[model samples]
Target: MALDLEGYLIDVERARGLEDIQTLILHLRDQYGVDHIVYHWVSSDGEQYGCGTYSPEWAQRYVDKDYLRVDPVVIGCFQRFHPVDWRKLDWSSKAARAFQAEARDYGVGRQGFSIPVRGPNGQFALLTVSHDCDDEAWDAFTLAHQRELILIAHYFNLKALELEHARAPEPIKSLSPREVDTLTFLAMGYSRGQVADMLSISEHTLRAYIESARFKLNAANTTHAITRAITEGLIVVGGTSRAADGGWPGRRTPS
Candidate 1:
């Protein structure tokens, strides 16, 4: 079945709970003619939330085995700010190969694309689509849908934040000047080392600033903190509007 992307997005935006997210992924799987579509997130405070089309048995087994510690997708995506093709991730390790084989046996697909999303307070997540298809076919599909998929990922992240806020509203914290500078450089695509040099700060000092900012923003990681800062208008980047008048709290925001 052809995916009515326009309609699907409406459904996505209308989703009211985690269960609704699961149902939407099921619909997306069928429409994309894919084996699965998944969105999984881990919050800064250690809460986990996810919705996907993978079979419950496989999902359970994965948890029971603690495969995440060795899952190449998780590891690879955590270090990246861009979308990734599964084939590009490391699979040379024996453990990874074994895991991949088992996943395939459980109906996982051979071709996949994942987008990593980082949210405030160290929250991390991945949005993924997978399919069983020849390499050429998979490539073509991704080429055609890449932009749409990216948009979907961003919407999912934003909606997830809204849901989180609804469940527990908190005060909004403003980033410190140093934190703002660090995140701005990062969002602009500067490498950590480059940023460190540009700021005339040692790498260690830079890391300290980043970690402090992450804590203040309640972010799950540096990238998440940066995203949160931008979204909340703690810092201006590239002429983007500072639409956020406020945001979530942990530390403090200047009035």
Candidate 2:
């Protein structure tokens, strides 16, 4: 039987390192009655890393042959944010077909599902479950556990992020009231001129505040700035504080 996801989330949170997470996925795979569970992440620095239940030989072979370039799952999942069923992806290319053959030859499962996850600073990861079952059986399994699988995927990502930061600790930077205001409005889809009007600042000044926030967040661009801000809780846009400084990470005086 699989571990209870409610209790499992606490285990995920208390996971002290990557190894603990790896063990958890093994337990989760048993819980879901799937053959394998995998988590793969790509960092902003272009570093690729993750853990999974795939056999050691196959995992190494995938890396040694650079299968990532030809793997349909990696290619298709990268383009979307939602959970994907393997049957729906395109596998028409010669290279893709050959890779699929090799994967199956290596004992990879015949049925698969993947969830794409995105996080701060251009980080991306995938949580996948695969098994060797008939189409109808796979469909029933996915339909039954879809919501819990999604929740597990996110919590796993969060713990992974926390562990990474613990190893390479970066101090959380604070944003100013005006900078928070600029990002909040921008995240709401406001144009620069519109944000300027709302903040009672000139477009020139608006640009400065955005640049400052971008620098503080170490974001690559304005869109990245807004994404990073929201992820880090420096500015909460969609939730409570739909408009202004109420969502800023900390209290700040008027600038």
Candidate 3:
């Protein structure tokens, strides 16, 4: 049966705490007919947190076995800027294969899709849904639900960040204009050199600006910087171009 994902999202938005988030995940798992749904986050200080539908025994086993060391999902997703399918990640190592087998035994499922979300202040998160299915069936499922899943991933990440921000010790700073310019072009899939030329700046200067922005935003890379900028409203998507006014080309405000 098809899931009422929209209703679930509304419920998720009303969640008050981590326990509530976990309850929502359990609902999603059953609703989507997936083996598990997991959302894991890491903050700037290296603090980790998560909410998921995985069994307590499996969760404990994962920690006890130090599966993070060999888990391809964690490693692969860390390096990727886009969503990834489980089949695309390398499971070539014996340790990785063993870990996968153990996960399967614990009912974590053989098929999975993961979205990597990077937020301001060195926050990194992953939203994953896994199930047991044939390759063809899984392909169809992912294709059909890809857009919804991406939206859901961002929604979940945003909600988690909001909660974190509410508990933060200090107020977060807004991105500078130069930082927003760099991120805007990057999000539109522009090459660094192209972006530099569009902004009438040298590539070296552009690199400096990007690095500064990354540092200020506590982003791990350019992609993360852009994602954070877009998520935090530092750069507007499909808005008027500030770049056209000789400020910096391609920089638009959100409408």
lDDT of 2 by residue, 177-237 (tens): 7898889889888899998999898999999999999999999999999898777777777
Predicted model with the maximum TM-score: 2
- For model 3, residues 22-86, the per-residue Cα lDDT tens digits are 88888777777778899988655545678898888987887777666688998898778698999
The residue ranges of model 3 lying beyond 4 angstroms of the native Cα positions read: 44-46, 171-255
> Candidate 3, which ten residues in sequence have the lowest lDDT sum?
240-249
- lDDT of model number 1: 0.83
Question: With candidate 3 superimposed using the best TM-score fit, by how many Å does residue 91's alpha carbon deviate from the native?
Answer: 0.7
Cα displacement (Å) at residue 117, model 1? 1.3
Question: Which of candidates 1 and 3 is the stronger one according to lDDT?
Answer: 1
Q: Evaluate residue 133 in candidate 1 and report its C-alpha lDDT on the 0 to 100 scale.
A: 91
- In candidate 1, position 114 carries an lDDT of 94
Kindly list the per-residue Cα lDDT of model 1 for residues 1-255, writing each as its tens digit.
Answer: 566778888888998988888888887777788889999786654456678988899889887887777789988988786989999999999999999999999988898899998877677888999889999999999998888888788778888888988988786566666777888888889999999999899999999999999998899988888888776668667743243343334433456
TM-score for each predicted model, relative to the true structure:
0.64, 0.66, 0.63
Angstrom error of the Cα, residue 252, model 3: value is 46
lDDT of 3 at 131: 92
Model 1: weakest 10-residue lDDT segment is 239-248
